[model samples]
Target: MAEIIGVIEQLWRYPVKSTGGERLDSVEVDERGLAGDRLYAVRDSAGKLGSGKNTRRFRRMDGLLRLSSRLGHRLDGPELFDPLGRPVADPTAFLRAYLQRPDVALAREDAVSHFDQLPVSVLTTATLDWVRGAAPAAVVDVRRFRPNILLRTPPGTPPFVEDGWFGREGGGGARLAFVRASERCAMTTVAQPGLPHAPEILKAIIQAHEGRLDALAEVVTPGRLSVGDELSLN
Candidate 1:
């Protein structure tokens, strides 16, 4: 029997990197990803992708981003706010705020522009447990992974092994489609504050879970999602 789970969860579109993400009760999905997901990004002084990928060059970005959003009418054009909860700026003041920190440096601020690895990342609680059981030393947390959707499935259900291919109905009757599995990198090794010390959690997941613990999906087709939308396999 195919079981259908109600609306799982909703994550807000966090445009900035490193700071914090906003949670939402409902949201609209789009092709690029959630309406506001990765809408903005940071660059090194020399205009390089300022993300965890090249931590040595932009390690300051590790804990410097802040993102938030509010209710809006259209999913295609929903407005995004800075970490301060202010409207998006013309040149984007958020980057300046991030660069002011001493830990951050500039090779050429205008020369780099790095987007997040994925527009919106999603993971499941079951997946976390699976990794934990396989690698006792691994301590997986949603924040460390920085996923946008954290669906809670049945206890016996498997982890989010194939999130890239799953789809569900939104409360507003929109359909969310899974696009592809997420490819991991070295950044996963970095520690998130307050989480247990499992420096190799990312490596552990790659070793045990067929080298994948999370997947990246997009709203290939626009849809509305609520807190309790039914989850369906594609």
Candidate 2:
């Protein structure tokens, strides 16, 4: 028997990795997760993808969060936009100039995945409220966490409630299994449009939750998901 838990309150798609994303009323979920999410990324001449942290596969690239991307009608790929919502004519040139890295360029994800870990990320309003209580002065916007789906739990739900859903399959139009708790990073503190740089946010998460905030999920079935769609646990 399945039990109703919450409804989809928000949906987000990141056309480009490590950049600001667009919110949607509805979205298509595929095996790779959201259809257009992280389809493109900023790559350097060394073949390392740009990210907030430096790893073997990702290079620390500042200012990526300041930019935003959206899927273009042409279907070629995503189009990059400036922080002010201006379209970038030549993304490679603009990025090279803005980042001051002459060897950097925008590229599509190929054999390597653009995602940092699991494809889909999930969060709940209860978790957000908890974080706000932990860091009273910091902004607790969902954009800071960059989740693909934001679940609105019923009133009186406690923080970190999604942790119990791990390994459980659920969704209304699509099926998703929560795999693990999402780890917080410095990117959560990065200042983007309408968000301020607040390192205290990450500090709070680390102290309270061992640096984990939300849930990372895998798509079990592909389908369309919309706002207000009920989510259940099976």
Candidate 3:
């Protein structure tokens, strides 16, 4: 049985790992995920990958959260976006200053783009709302969590509904097989652009859902996904 629950709220891609990401009206989903998602990252001289999760390596990836990455249909045509949605020309040097490491270099994920778990991650407005209720003091920005797909659940849907989608087929344009609940990491607590540092964010997730906030999936049959599209769970 297939169920239609909601519309796609937003499609997000983080060109550079741990940095900011841009929203898309539509995107082509491939085996590696959205064409340009997490395809590039900032690497250090020691070959350590830069990520909000790998704080020991960069020490300030949270600041990178203030910077966002964007790209056109072509992979080579990548750009960085500021908080105000303005394009930035020199993301390397700009990110280096925030990280305070002159040796850090931008490299594609081919070497190390910083993927934590599965290729695709999804979250729902219901879960976000529940977390907000759990942690009113901390800012509950979805950017802090960095999910690849965001779905706006139907009205009155219960929180943590993503867990129910496991083992089900999902997506409108792109067909995906839900795998498991994505485990939360320290990265969620880091400060992202427009969001301040709030360690309690992770605490809310742990207390509410045992440290899992979203569902992870893999492409079953590659296709495209777009905002306002309807995803079905079967």
Candidate 4:
């Protein structure tokens, strides 16, 4: 029998890579992961992927942090929203002005999602609480972590319990196997909207949790995932 672990607290979909994502009440999950998640990416002059993390050719592009998008025409791709949450027809020009990079362009993902590692990621409330406890002075919001699913673990469940869910099945038929603990980066420390720039927040993660606050998951069984759905370990 499967044991009840937690309820899905929030659902998010990033239609464009390395940009602010939007919350959803419920979502469809396919093999590639959430529908309309990371289907678009910012391409630089040299055609390098513009990632939030400052990793090599994937330059750190924080300007996109204040922006978001929604699924527009299936053939045309996502329609981007401005920093003020207003939709813009020409996303490339809008983003260029925001990032001050005229050479950059918004392009659709070729064959797969532009996910950093795995297509899906989950973060437990317990883990967020740990970060807050570790850095009480800094604001702790789920947006910093950018997880596809935010789970509210049962009360009294210890933090980092997600680490143990590796190689487990959850809900009705969605099987998840942890690729590895997600590595923290400077992106989490960046300020965006309600979040403040707090370098110590990432420091605490490194000191206490080895710089990982969430876990990446790969779907073995495709199914619908919702805000109230309960997760279980198989």
Candidate 5:
């Protein structure tokens, strides 16, 4: 039987990748995932979605880009801006400014937009602990995983076990069950703000553990979630 360990401790939303994220008091989930999570993304002129791979050519795309979120009554709604502000129509310009890339500014149509993935990427505390134990050198920041939700699960369990969770909890709140373990990419290996040797540490953990150092769960239902909300399972 599955067990409810703890409520979600941290909720994060990254309007864009590589850029910093905002901690949420609460968040809404839609069919995709977290709302305002990856609503828009920068696609190249050829209409290919940008992945962290092949950084040799698209080096600018690998760096952090900033974004904000605003809650609208509907899915196709206006986004709330973070303290840093939102990217207007020309995202490439904003990307150039954010990362100081003159040649790469406004390079695409949705250059400064969110991706189409579910807005929320949820992770459990148990997963965090498991990772911490495996990779002590890992800074373990949410940005490393780009997750929208930082959930707390049962202790001692490895990351991604939540891939099997389903249905509403015993209490009353909605449940965004786990669908599958997120397949990680080279991005997890990038060095970032709090972590300098991120790639080396992630490689070590992957060797000692199983695959990547962390896991992500998808929200199955569509609704709003707050930080202090209680979570339980039967």
Candidate 6:
């Protein structure tokens, strides 16, 4: 028998990598993960995707988080918007001017994945409360963590409860298998709209929790999921 753990509080989909995403009341989940999630990205001259930290496949591109993107009716890609909510007519030119990188351009994800790690990322309200308690002075917001699914656990539920779900399958409609704890990065400290520059947010996770705050997951059964759906461990 499966045990009920929590209800889905929010769903997020990032059409463009390393940018702000849109909240949804409901969304479709596929084998690739959330539909339209990270289908596009800012690519540099060296072919590295834009990200918060420099890696083998990712290049640290500052100010990418200030941008927001959403999936339009087009199947080709999502529509990019600037920090001020204005639509971008030319993504390549806009990205070049915005990031001050002459060789940077917008591109879609190909055979290689655009995700930082796993296909999905999950966070719980209990962990948020823990972070707030740990760093009372820091502004702890869900946007800083950038989870694809936000679960609202019942009262009295312990923080970091998602850690136990690793190697377990759970979801409301779309089945997901928790794989590993999502690692924190320097991106969490970057200031964005309605968020302030707070490095202490990442510091609290590192000092108290070893820099992990959420769960990274992979889709086991593709389906539709909605806010308020009950989640259980199977």
Top lDDT model: 2
Tens digits of per-residue lDDT, candidate 3, 109-219, equal: 664436667889999998888888888999888887788888998889999898888878877898998889888877788766667788888887888788998889999
Tell me which of candidates 4 and 6 scores higher on lDDT. Answer: 6
Rank the candidate models, highest lDDT first.
2, 6, 4, 3, 1, 5
> What Cα-based lDDT does every candidate model obtain?
0.54, 0.91, 0.80, 0.81, 0.53, 0.90
Runs in model 2 deviating more than 4 A are 72-75
lDDT tens per residue, model 4, 1-234: 878788999989888887888788877787888878888899888767788766544777877777777773253688788877889988888878888999999988775347787888899998999888999999989999999999998779899988887766565436666667788888898877777788999999999878877878887777788788888876
Backbone N/Cα/C clashes per model: 16, 0, 2, 0, 23, 0
> How much does each candidate deviate from the true structure in C-alpha RMSD?
6.0, 1.1, 2.4, 1.9, 5.3, 1.1
Question: Candidate 5, after superposition: displacement of residue 81 in Å?
Answer: 10
Listed in order, each prediction's TM-score against the native is: 0.67, 0.97, 0.89, 0.93, 0.68, 0.97
lDDT of 1 at 137: 66
- Could you tell me how far off, in angstroms, the CA of residue 202 lies in candidate 3 after the best superposition? 1.2
Q: lDDT by residue for model 1 over 149-197, one digit each (tens)?
A: 7777676867664553545322234544455666666556565445544
Candidate 2 lands at a TM-score of: 0.97
Those runs of model 1 whose alpha carbons end farther than 4 Å from true positions after fitting are 1-6, 10-12, 55-62, 65-118, 135-139, 163-172
TM-score head-to-head 2 vs 5, winner: 2
Error of 5 at 131 (Å): 2.3
| Per-residue C-alpha lDDT of model 2 across residues 1-234, encoded as one tens digit per residue | 999889999999999899999888988889999988998999999899999999999999999999999884333788899989899999999999999999998898899999999999989999998988888898779999999999999999999998999979988899998889988899999999998999999998898889997889899999999999999999
Q: lDDT tens string, model 6, 98-120? A: 99999988898887789989999
Point out where model 6 deviates above 4 Å.
72-74
Query: In candidate 5, what are the lDDT values of residues 89-156, reduced to their tens digit?
Result: 55566555654545443222244334433334556776666666667766766667766656666556
lDDT assessment of candidate 4: 0.81
